[model samples]
Target: MFMVYVSETQPLVDFLRSIKNGSTVLMASYDEPATKLSEEARNLIAEMGSTYVKSLGFRDNWVFVGAKALPVKLCLFQHIKNNDKTNVYENWPEIIDMDGCIPKHME
Candidate 1:
C-alpha cells in the first residue's frame, strides 16, 4: 500500500488518475482544521472508481470507504491544523509513530 498525505485535491486526483483499473486505494486522514480539501475530493475519488470508507468517531484511526485490507497501491493522507504542537493522530502509536504529548483519547 502507498501512503500519501492529502492536504488538497490535486495530489489526490493525480494519484487516482495514476491507478490502474480494478486496483484499490486505501486512504486515511486526520480531519485537521488545516485540511483544505473541498467536496470535490470525495467526488473525484468516487469518479476515479475508488471506494470511500465512512470511519467516523475513531479519531485518527480510520479506513477509506470502510474497505478491508486496503490494496497495495493504497495511499494514506492527512493534514494537521496545528503543526507546532502535535497532531491528533500523533498520540495514536499504532497509527502515527510520533513522540509527543498524548491525547486523552490515547491515554
Candidate 2:
C-alpha cells in the first residue's frame, strides 16, 4: 500500500492537484528545508540505526509531481518523527493514487 503522508507544511499542493489518486507516480528529487516536526521524524529513524530515511531525503521533503498512466506498481510511505516518540511511524501511510496523475503527453 502507498501513501502521501502530508504534514503541517507540504510544499507541492498545487502540483499535486494536477494528479489523481491510484495513478502511477514518479519520485521526483527534493532537497529543501522541512518542518521541525518532519526533521524529528528522520531523526527518530536514524536513532533506530536505520539509514534508509537519509537516502529518502527529509520527511515530506519530496512530493509526487509527475506520473505515467502505466500499470506500474509503486508504494509511497510517509515517515515522520515526533516528540511523542510513540513509534507511530510504523503503521501509518496515507494512500495516494497516481495512475491518473500521468501527463497527457506521456500517455
Assess candidate 2 and give its TM-score to the true structure: 0.25
Tell me the alpha-carbon RMSD of every candidate. Answer: 11.8, 13.8
lDDT (tens digit, per residue) of candidate 1 on 56-97: 222344434212233333333332233324544354323443
State every prediction's TM-score relative to the real structure.
Answer: 0.38, 0.25
**Per-residue lDDT of candidate 2, residues 1-107 (tens digit):** 22334444233333434455444544522323243324554443333233444555333333333232334433343333322344334332232333443334332
lDDT of the candidates, in the order given: 0.40, 0.37
Off by over 4 Å in 1: 1-7, 31-35, 47-61, 65-107
lDDT of 2 at 56: 59
What would you estimate as the lDDT of candidate 1?
0.40
Q: After TM-score superposition, what is the CA distance of residue 66 in candidate 2 from its true location, in Å?
A: 11
